[model samples]
Target: MYVFSAQRRAISIICIYMTYPYTTWQNCVYSIDRR
Candidate 1:
């Protein structure tokens, strides 16, 4: 159970980094530029 919890924590951290706020900010900029 401890190992599974650790694995899930690692995966969550990875997912957070993969779709980080900076990437979303860049997408927002592109949309603003289109205006």
Candidate 2:
């Protein structure tokens, strides 16, 4: 159970790391579209 929980945490961290940049890029594009 502990290992499973650790894996879940790692996946969550990786997902956040991956999404953070994409989300920022999306926001940047959205702002550009507004201009």
Candidate 3:
């Protein structure tokens, strides 16, 4: 049970981080396109 919860938390954190990376990548692309 403890292992399952730990995996869930890790997955959640990974998902959040992945989203953040994608957003930053998109923002960078937009800025470059604007220029």
**What tens-digit string does per-residue lDDT give for candidate 3 at 1-35?**
13436655565555567667566544543454466
lDDT by residue (tens digit), candidate 1, 1-35: 13446655565556557657655534543454466
| TM values, all candidates | 0.43, 0.43, 0.41
**Per-residue lDDT of model 2, residues 1-35, tens digit only:** 13436655565556566678676544543454466
What are the clashing pairs of model 2?
Answer: none
What overall lDDT goes with each candidate model? 0.53, 0.54, 0.54
lDDT of candidate 2 at residue 13, scale 0 to 100: 59
Question: Model 3 clash pairs?
Answer: none
TM-score for candidate 2, please give it: 0.43
Best by lDDT: 2
Which ten-residue region of model 3 has the weakest summed lDDT? Answer: 24-33
